[model samples]
Target: MLKHALLSLLLLITIHTSNAATPKGPLEILRHSLVQEVFAFGIRPQDTNWFDIEVSTNLTDWSRLATALSTNATAFFVDDSATNAPTRFYRLRIPGTTVAQQQAIWTELRRRTYTIQVERISSSGKYLSADVTVTSGAKHISNVKDPLTGEAVADFDPADFPSIEEIFTKLEAAAQTGIYDLRVWYDPKHGYPTRMIQREISGMNSNVTELRFNLVER
Candidate 1:
């Protein structure tokens, strides 16, 4: 009787240890913003191919916002609608998998980039305003263009305003012709740029421009 009891105890211990070591993908919230009011979470791609983003005001009740697929690595989600409410909660649920969701994830990850809100005044007393959005490593300028003999119209990076060094070179040139003022704001998490202001102060023709980058989804 004593030998049988010892064997059963050993078996239970082994089973419990094995279960504890089993790999199960989990989701974790990395960062969040209240003023921007965005919440972010990362989900590792596991046996399931698709996951659902469920948002809730209270933890007990959740509303499904989006169904997304995963690549080989972890995937990120940013909830911008959090800005509208006083408080919000989010979670990632592995409901099911689908081929369409897989394709959509690829497309979304490809298109996810940055947007720039540009406002500028030229030395000639002319004002140029525009929005620039970067998609798939290309920049689409909304309102402004280059008038110089040879200069880039726009640039893009996953992080900040594309070609920041090039922009500084232009700013210095503008200052040489007149006066230049530059200001920048950076996201604390990644140390990437978020907002900027550049002013050309050469006299009455001085042009002031502002550019705000969308650091993340919000």
Candidate 2:
């Protein structure tokens, strides 16, 4: 099959934008504020495409709030229902770009078995690096070892290093929430993600994942 490896890191940041410059790109939220149970967002669009505004409490399930055509360069959206949920996230997306495109790649990954190396740096500055192996027909990870010492490392929770399938889940969730700018590079041969960077739009947090693969069997 194939061998796969990952190096991931999480960082937190603050993003600051200049009020004097016109924001350009996909639909972007220029500003957001909450007052007296009402949430308001200032948005700007680079193009005239129709967009859907969605809200989610959990990243996985999103509820449509509105659909509007962006004929103008700038607009404001106010959510009166914000008070109903203690925490919520909002995103604006074009009609067909979220789940369908990602599903194709996730499906291919499930059919292959590979060994992977995982290195992670947390926002708190903790770091772990290990090599992992997965078998196509197995229910659990086949192996995890220190790349340097060649010894088993027990300090980690298996959850820390996700399977290819789990990574896809995260990708989908972030896409739905519309909190991050997702950038991905896929292996040309195996059609799997080689690198992914999720940078939060509001500049609050970011995650970067890098995967390197080695084929051991078919």
Those runs of model 1 whose alpha carbons end farther than 4 Å from true positions after fitting are 1-25, 45-48, 97-218
Residue 105 miss distance in model 1 (angstroms): 21
Please state the error at residue 209 of candidate 2 in Å: 6.5
lDDT of every predicted structure (CA atoms): 0.44, 0.51
Q: Looking at model 1, which ten-residue stretch has the lowest summed lDDT?
A: 9-18
Give the top-scoring candidate (lDDT).
Answer: 2
TM-score of 1: 0.32
Model 1 C-alpha lDDT versus the unseen true structure: 0.44
Give the backbone clash total of model 1. Answer: 0
lDDT of 1 by residue, 1-218 (tens): 53432232220000111144563535443333333445444545353334445566656776655544433254545555555655555555544323333334434443356655554443445333445676655666554444343344454332223433334344334334432334344443333334445544345665655554443354
Q: Using Cα atoms with residue i matched to residue i, what is each candidate's TM-score against the true structure? A: 0.32, 0.43
